[model samples]
Target: MGDASVVEKIYDLVVIGAGWYGLGSAKAYIQLHPNEKILVLEAENSCGGTWSKDRLYPGLKSNNLWGSYEFPDFPMEEKVYGVSEGQHIPAATLHRYLTDFAKNFGIFERTLFQTKVDSVEATANDEWALNVTSNTSTIQRIQTKKLIVATGLTSQPNMPSYPGEESFVPPFFHAKEFCNRADTVQTCKKATVVGAGKSAFDVAYAFATEGDAQVDLIIRPTGQGPVWICPPYVTPLKRKMEELLSTRALTFMSPCPWQGEDGFSMAHSFLHRTGVGRFIVNNFWNQISSEVVETHGYNDDPEVFKLKPWNSAMWTGSGVGIHNYQTNFFDLVKEGKIRVHLADIVKLDQNTIHLNNGEAFETEVLICATGWKKTSEGLKFKNFSSGLSYTTSDIKRLSKEADKKVHEMFPILKDQPVLRGPVKAEEPLRNYRFIVPSGAVFKRNIAYAGMVSTVCTSIFSTVQGLWISAFLDGKLQRAPKTEDEVTKEIMLHTQFEKWRYPCGYGASLPDFAFDSIPYVDLLVNDLGLKNHRKSSPILELLEAYKPKDYLGLGEEWVEAYGNQ
Candidate 1:
């Protein structure tokens, strides 16, 4: 009787993409909710999702330290993680660690490798029709009550469409293509880098330090902020302690006893803006300014170039300025070792870049350092969507046309818990469809690595995507029984700026200090967190709360192997 309990090929939950968030949620959910029939589907062979694919980059390293960068359940191997040149662990080492974590957590057993998801459609029964396409000859259709999308934004690389882009006489490619440093060097001698973003800097730095390749990068106007004193991506504990004390003192001494904004505090604004992507930041960004640096294109935008208080929420990332790391790229350019052009790219002829400003560059290699876009247009989810398709036009059209406000196709009841400008007494339909949040409830299937919640913007493509599956398990919720209801939720959320997204802008940082309280006591005290969730949020509900013996430290887990 016990062996037949799980005979159904169909599952209660299906997690797409076995990446960091997917794996993390799998471990967490399995530990927290036993007996839940959950299976993870991965498209690639071998694990470590992104890391497994990018073994070509010879000396890749993370920007953050091994200590702060680790997941709560898994810590990096101490011997392999200690820094010599300021990085926590080598990319390859971290990849191995992730492999180990999966084994210990038992995530590998339920994963379907090399199996591509063909289609996912909802039935009249409120369940989902999931079509799985495998490299092998078998394609299976399974039913699941919930779906989790753990594929982060960088799943697809964005390639720019420059005129004559095809005319590039030399071979062209994105950073994702080159895995090893030797390949990076052999590809370009006088490399022309396009786009001045984090990836551009990362590519540049990789070429410079790892492969020793010289690069001439073309930079457009970065964000609109004053030249900040960007620092190196290194952490000196002494400096950190000083900054912490200063921040603490400033916080307490503020006129309103709140975390007030300070003038040109680079570190303060960095954590807010960098939350947009999956890349770990070096924190050196807050120490540099763009004024001293030079790049291609219009350096206009008074708002980004000008200084502002640290209103990370009000800025909506639009207020952000060019990060400090890119400015450092100029130092290489000014040495006449690498060149920078200010003209716009007009055309591309075989091996030559035509600029509108009467400039042309002949090249053997061209690197489009442009960032990736977050739409699923090219993705094969078409067959899987089962009639679910939301083009950018569809979202805009629905927002303009819808009169009645419904959450996920269900009619909003009286006294619906509407949030921001999502559900109104009048028109609804304005949210970005990727999220597909709650219809009439205050919450949605949204939450990131405990960072972004539904408040900022429910990132349907990242870890926040998994929360959607989590919500699906609880059919107990009354709102959102159909697809139309889901559409209504999207349209309604589009009314306000995305700063309201959980784990996005304006979302208060968690009080890492109060974690010392036991889960039972914390539930009773019921701080502001309780207003949004039960006791310690997911930690309390899932019984994953870490009991702390001191401020900001959980001694229980630390002492698990004590007495040695």
Candidate 2:
């Protein structure tokens, strides 16, 4: 822990979490206000939130390729990082790149690692009082004029409780802790993994290939089925998957309500509004889905066919994953090395797992690849003036109104996929532009980044960092000025997420895949900056947008609007 006097001092800005969003936000703010005192608090020992040293396990690779995963200002050079453009970046390489990004931008000097924020309250003096504790057991109070919560969605793991897990457990844990228990991959004879997400598949694959273990992958019959896993390349042209999703022309094919601002209002309307255009858009998505399914040979065996996604690629948000493994992941399953079970765990008893479908499995290790908790779970947020925590009412009424508006604006969203099982109801977040809470728009002292889930997180985090900095600096010309306007805006976006990504985390935060570019366009426009980064209209539509296109955005904003 630092000195007691240091904790007593107040700062111009304080950022929580040292991940991609936190580092990006701090760098952007400091660029605009060079002399301001800024501090970043991270719970982990090092940077790179999800890719931190504590989380990397064997066989873990990024869904993103080399070019699409890097920050715009600091390119991950092929020579420097030893990674090529088409290859999926390894976890170690990404961690090294993020650490270097922090050091290069001076964010490392401003950050305090292993400091966990216990609670945060709004002070009467219009500041934020953060009560934090370090790993050394030292507690202190730190205050800041502005706060940005960039903890993101992956901080806390969601470990479900089973009936007899306490007594029957033999090395049972969540996948996030795989780094610590990595020896289990080589030692375990048999392993059982729960859930069907990316993490589950990665864990099962590691056990099946790295060791002599027989892996059992359990996909709950009541939960969302297997996710759509696409190859690295797609389409008849064999374009990179991430590149295809990032291209404006391909993104425009998705029924996004905000794509009209791309200077193709007529084309957007014709594609999403007319019957013939809808057929073309639907056919495009269907073809992409069919190609992926056929490439994987899911139909070769009945058990392998069960791995096919329950929802269409168009309706599935971030649930769609990339097949970035070195070898064919399905080959092991076909060879009886990995078995898939479509049943829920009934109980665990002494290295045995009883299923709801009258089946019992004996395994030496049990790894739960279950998802994460809500981003706002750990910290307590309180409103300064009211002396009460912020809460929302009439969400149902607002959702109805917003749903009607979305259907009227984009009729294509009305045709939603039929979801299996009961989805746990999630309260829509009330943050304006998914950054500042609707009530805090006037305060402008608190904001959030990386709370929104998207495939193009590099671009989103960079643009969101600029938006939050400008809004905190009071330079945004298009921010909502009135409370009612901000509330309505937040409500509409929240409801649009519900309709756009019903199968993913849309109900809690902004979640999308291909629609990330248009979402960034909205933020760019709000900052009074040009959304188009390319020179020609043809290139702008066809060429994929990478971090390079958004390079030096903070400098551009300051140059255009002056760093007042």
Candidate 3:
């Protein structure tokens, strides 16, 4: 709303969404291509993306440690987050960190706050035309050579409609909206939460433990796979185990390794395609899950509730990384303050929620902890000739087709145990190496940030931003040149996905929820940066990498590989 005057402006890069991903993307591009003009369009009034206004709910704390979750270039101010600074910070603290990061890195000045992009499509000249609407109701057209969708994963909230939900008298909304109005729940007598993710548990836990409201956590039988409950931080023993089975060592064991040859490689495809490799990775995670369950006294029974393979899919790791501070979650259930109902709601009346188990519950508030829509759907693009919307479904279909070609080429994988499951290609905005969609014919200039799910959200986003920038700057290589090659690569990744998270289909997107170290190494190595690991080889091979250990690595990489 700063200026109603609409003018056409051309930028070298137009980044949508001013959240963490957007900020990182803009920062990376500007740092590398200092002369290039980059504009970040955020719909919100302030920075921080999800960590900003959308997140200020009670009991909402980070799952990952702040030490690893912070921006590499800018360290978070000490004594601001967690008990001793650098632990699991609260949502408000994270919001501050993001805004602070933008200010420190000069990302705030180039960002267009309160600006929303309505649509982006490829023009005749291969450039992108973005129809933007500002908070002032003013419209503007932006033309850019490259468009980076940095909205991250949680852009659109998925609000599933129930039969009588529209007529419900009490407060009813998605978890995102509920967070926006969490204060109202303090007065409510009972709160009913639907879904089985971190949001669901957090909302239910907050209402039950903190407020006067009794909470009913309704987990649908047909919902996404079982949640693997675990503490947010990895213990000393777990960290040691991660080092022994590090990607560096695993890559050496692989017969087909990712060479420093191209923009992308099928090295991971080869590693995970084999049964032995799959067994080792899966077994390692199983051990971790067992340890977490034993340590926390969490339940994960194979006969009653099969734990989703942690190493299988992205974002499927220890389901909700709740902080250790919320230790009374299960205790609340035991004390009858929080009720865990493992059944779906059959119907909802004006004052009652009828479950599939024929049990009727009365609640004053109903919160849908249901997950968001596929992040790919947030990327609204159109096929230049067909005028059809480029959707997440299309991405899934393309990957499926790619997988088909791969199975045909590698018949041995056709009968592979990992390949036996139904292809879970439902989520959208599928990209090559979790960035740009290689299957799309037009607008190849667009790259997606934050599509992949990892334990360390900020670190993953930062690396993605740098990778996108390097790809745009023509410093790194791209995915395969041919469709067949891309298909083969995606097929192996899909198989890898299956082996890692067997129940990833329940996820909103195909989360690349793997260890952060190797993924970052892949990005940095592909970007042609020098080995950024500062630790000793023995330590690197023995311990899991954290953000604190790699502080300023991104800056170092930019200085070494930028505009190469």
Candidate 4:
């Protein structure tokens, strides 16, 4: 809402995307640099990236529980939000909380809604120039000394096309549009959902129970099969799944490169290095997988059995989901209300879809639950001097070397899973510690947040926010001094992710679940702060890490390194 003359004024910092990570970064920066002029640019009219108001549909809930999803500094109180412990937070509740967060932290006034950053380039004066467009078709240029991108990975929907689809049109759209097209579920007598991810399950359930319409779920034979859906409270102990996963002891079972940083070096070596320890670790994962299958009763019915996960749980990253519905979702399939098909759509005709398995289905509605694009395409980044993209040909050469080294260290990942199709090899994202680009670390003028996909997003975002503020303010004590060291560290970390989470999106992003705590520890140590938040070593090993555990981490960083 400002005039063209406003572009001449340079800002100290500019942040893109007003979602969870974006708001967190802005709040952290403002807390550290109180008087700096910082602005936040958001394309949506509102905040809450994935949980924005326009995106909320009926019966939608987060995979994470209430206690594990809030920021470290702000707790989602029961009296304020009406969400209690152990219950999955509704999409609306999360949106409200984020709206309140922005206002409380003074970020709402700094954010520019409906403004999209088209591209960004480095300037000769070691600053960033951004080309932005508003919803009213107003184009403008803005400059800032530092920039933080938090658009995340789910900004763009990945919709696939089938042959002859133009002829048959009965409300065909992606699942992300379900909120706007809610009438399709109420009016259609029958509907078909494509893909087998968490979104697919949610759509099928809504169609079957909410609308009482027959639903067909199609999972392509060539792609990864259904994901592992665990009950809210799993195992014989009946401990909350999110809490169990947050414990440091549970992460030791998973092979992670940085778990040893938590003062468990001996345990890490035994589990990943010794053959006997390997046997024990494998059995632990097998038992967990078996428990999920039995808990869901997948083997009782043939149609329900089709929902079993195709890969081992050890190889899974974010592919694992939580079953937070009020009723048993499998019961609907067992009753023959929601059908499951393991086939690919060959073509689409008028009110009909042909499958590669010599089958055809006629439906009045089609909803695609396919995943999102791997990276954000809205912003284009370029080098100031070279005028080239951040990604270069050297990535391929360095990645190959990193792969060999990772295989040597973790031999368990040597045997890779085989997908059916000719999968396109994507170049791994080259960012040191999954934040700054390796080539631009010395500049310290640009950073990324929420780029990695993890179940513990709140914890990761808060720690990352503090870390970014420290690095940009020249308060970090253990940062790499040379570009060569930064590049080497980035390549090795990316390669480890490739092997650690083979079935998920690890090839292009840092995707993890239980290992998030260790990842945060790495960042905390770099800021010259204590990684352990608990009072005793025993408690640190057994207790679950939550948002409250990290309360005052920003102040902790300030106490240790603020003066520098």
Model 1 misplacement above 4 A: 1-8, 55-59, 80-86, 180-182, 209-212, 221-229, 232-330, 378-436, 439-564
Number of backbone collisions per candidate, in order?
47, 1, 11, 0
lDDT of 3 at 240: 28
- In terms of TM-score, which candidate is stronger, 1 or 3? 3
lDDT of 2 by residue, 1-564 (tens): 222224434899999999999988988888888898888899898899999998999988899998899899999999999999688999998899999999998898888888889888988877899988886435488889999999988988999899998898689999999999999999998999998898999999999988869999999877778988889898779998888888999887877767766767888888888999888989988988889889998877887887988877887787678998878889888888999999989899998999998999899999999989866477776654321123445666777888899998788899888878887786766687888876578888988898888889899889999999999878896877677777677778888888888778777677878888888888899888889999999899999999899997887888889745
| Candidate 1 per-residue C-alpha lDDT over 16-58 given as tens digits, one digit per residue, 9 for 90 to 100 | 7676667766665565345778777777665565566554364
- For lDDT, candidate 3 versus 4, the one ahead is 4
Q: Alpha carbon lDDT of residue 315, candidate 4?
A: 79
Please list the residue runs of candidate 3 whose C-alpha ends up more than 4 Å from where it truly belongs after superposition. 1-8, 79-86, 233-282, 298-315, 318-320, 376-379, 384-428, 439-444, 477-484, 505-508, 548-564
lDDT for position 162 in model 3: 76
TM-score, each model? 0.60, 0.96, 0.82, 0.96
lDDT of each: 0.42, 0.85, 0.63, 0.85
Per-residue CA lDDT of model 4 for 1-564, tens digit only, reads: 222224334789999988989998999999999899998888888889998888888789999998899998889999999999778999999999999999999898788888889889888888999988876435488889999989988789999999999998788999889989888778987999999899999999989988999999999887878988999888788888878778999888887777777778898888877899888888988888889889998887799999988877787887688998989899999998999999999999999999999999899999999989967777787654311133566666777898888877677778777755566677766688898876568888888898898888899889999899888877787889876777677878888998888778787788887788989989999988889999998889888999889999999878877776
Scored by Cα lDDT, where does model 1 land?
Answer: 0.42
Q: After superposition, how far is residue 336 of candidate 1 from its true place, in Å?
A: 3.1
Collision pairs in model 2: 168-350
